[model samples]
Target: MSDFVLTTPVVLTIFNRAHLAKRVFEEIRRAKPTKLYVIADGPRPNHPYDKERCLAARAVVEAVDWDCQVFKNYSDDNLGCGRRTASGLDWVFSMEEQAIIFDDDCLPHQTLFRFYQEMLDRYRGDDRIVSISGNNYRFSGQRLHYSYHFSRFPHLWGWATWRDVWQRYYDFKINLWPEIRDNNWLTDIFGLVQAEAGPSSEVFKTICRDEDIRYWSRKFNIIHKEMWNTWDYQFFFMCFLQNGLAVLPNVNLVSNIGFGDEATHTCSVTELANVPTEPMTFPVLHPPFMIADAFADAYMQLIFNRSC
Candidate 1:
């Protein structure tokens, strides 16, 4: 890890959680990336306490002592989850060609910086690989010999992506979902999984079925209607739309500590809350080919079916 240098910019999205932001900032400070982009949503007018808390959270990033150019994108109005995240990334890519992203609650192992830097470099020109995620759901006991595997699901607890991928695929308003939905275009992406096989083996069929498809279809319709204050679903929709895969580490690299009353979305303690992180073994053993592990993807689908 000594040879690792995080030339890629780092994007940290924060809200009214000074304590959590401070903790995440410690790691960012440790990584000492050359460029740091901090995105903050303004305090909600209804929550009288939000102003002080939001300012405190924004203050933590000011402790940057290292040689770094810190960029701040602070909003005066409350944009909620969807608009804030989408617009933040938009501001980031507008300047950077690529960036490693973090929500203040998603703490990362030190190795994550190295992992993202390398993955982003390796797949920089590859359009089929949309994004790289730091989270490993750990749904199954099986382990892979490589450092990471391809996944259709890009978990955003901690993640990275190229500017081109985001600008081309993601839509904050989800304006195209209706067109895709009306034409039943989503089936073209996962249709093979519903068949006897897809990507590699029959397990894909076992894991992704009509029920799973319907679950996602329902999700698309819901997010398309803006039922939830989220931006990730639309990102995943773009991944499927372009037949792209995300690179997910073999082990969990991020632990979400942002659960409890202060959290907007993750307000309750769940299995995903504060999961442990393990450092990725460096000089990553790349899979001989780029293919989603069907068995693993199957388990991932099952977990979504159960959890969502």
Candidate 2:
């Protein structure tokens, strides 16, 4: 029997996009998860829709009608980006063995439930495999088949991971510069490109800088030695160091929905609206390719050149 089920709690972190957050809520309802953990932070002062956003976010919970348990960690005072997000994540992983986490702007494909379930079951015992994520940017020659790919980047829009894997996660390092020095193994770990944030990284880091020092800088510290990445570029490094793999779907199973002005990050408004949402299958094809250190350096050069 498979340990996979569609009834697990889907954790959502919301901070003011009432409208888009509702869409995410409805999608979760369609899945009919057994439990739902909502961590909604209070809006920052001077921001528009301060009251409306909170009310709209709360309405999502009230609209739901089922045998669902909602656990809320609402902030009376705004904890900004760092404390609010990092603390909420700390609370969510405190309970379940695995979970499907999403921000307010992300919309899920109907099949995301099964995809997370199967990935959870497949890599349950593998400490090497830290997370199962949605949204792969490079689909040109990529297959719609189930296979593991490496990532050092963080793809927070939609992703899944085990609590055990998260237990090793310590999000606060104040300064990553020293960790770089302490860890001799990090020479190939964080190259110049991995040190800075690019298109998506910059957008998010800007929002988080006010609350947390900066997500990219924080992540650079985390992987300063060798840690799992759920961040944009950190995903690649995370997989490379562990020699882990990611399961990719045959079709584009997920899409990015955070391209609006209300979005804290990803407000560029790209043409990703046309991507199809298909459920991925299990028994994925494990790619033989491993992300080598040389490749990491080359990628860093390209990313740095393009961004600079």
Candidate 3:
């Protein structure tokens, strides 16, 4: 589709990875989004080389050659991932109603821009749908009748969302996590029975599902407690709170390529790192009904439980 033009706004969040940021920015350049917003975190004072690396990463956006309006929200002092991204996005949605988001590490396929644009238009007023995800964590394919399926989880590597979802659901402070955890509300939210973890095969399956609940429960505690800090958990908090669904494509559209010493969470190689993305063919088929694929979500839960 040579005539295809991207009109949606795009947001890029970058820290100190110049190389990875450049890779992501190049694809955005190709997509030629009409409006581009960049959010950059300042360098850590403790890290000796953070300033230079951060500056280099910020400069990558200066190479934008297309005719696009670019807005920048740069921090002079480090706000860390959680604060920087939350504050950055607050600035982004203030200017536009909806936009696709990317981290420095998330390399997007050309088709992702079109896919997200269509989803934004089709589901503009659908309050049940909170985000549009470009990630399919399963390396092995999950058979589906449509081009995409609804997901209970929010994958932030490369995703899109509207101002309503962002303003209403996203809790950077994770204020409600404690009440959910204390009252054991996740089971109700997930529609899962309160099955205890056991070893039997049928029970083992239930246990795995419970592990998914526990995995997020523990994560929320950590994020709220400041034991670990990042942006995704807070996004997920509102999704879980509202039982919101993210539209996940059948084919992977974004690849995480920043796995190295300089990386934060992706410090070591894992199956998720450098996941190869393939083009999603045209005339995307939307699912006839709006329902989360339980089989796919369960399978993903089993995979995610391995880390927990």
lDDT (0 to 1) per candidate: 0.87, 0.62, 0.87
Q: Total clashes, candidate 3? A: 0
Q: How close to the true structure is residue 194 of candidate 3, measured as C-alpha lDDT?
A: 46
Best by TM-score: 3
Over 4 Å off, model 1? 193-208
Backbone clash pairs in model 2 (N, Cα, C under 3 Å; residues 3+ apart or in different chains), count: 25
Provide the TM-score for each candidate, comma-separated: 0.91, 0.72, 0.92
Regions more than 4 Å wrong, model 3: 194-208
> Candidate 2: TM-score?
0.72
| Selected candidate, larger lDDT, 2 vs 3 | 3
Error of 2 at 306 (Å): 4.5
What C-alpha lDDT does candidate 2 achieve relative to the native structure?
0.62
Residue-level lDDT tens digits of model 3 in 78-111? 9988889989999998889999999999999999
lDDT of 2 by residue, 71-128 (tens): 9889876676556766787799888888888887778887777767776887787856
lDDT at position 251, candidate 3: 85
Q: Residues 74-163, candidate 1, lDDT per residue (tens digit)?
A: 999999978999999999999999999999999999999998999999999898899999888777755578889898887888899999
Considering only N, C-alpha and C atoms within 3 Å, which residue pairs clash in candidate 1? none
Q: Residue 261 in model 1: shift from native, Å?
A: 2.3
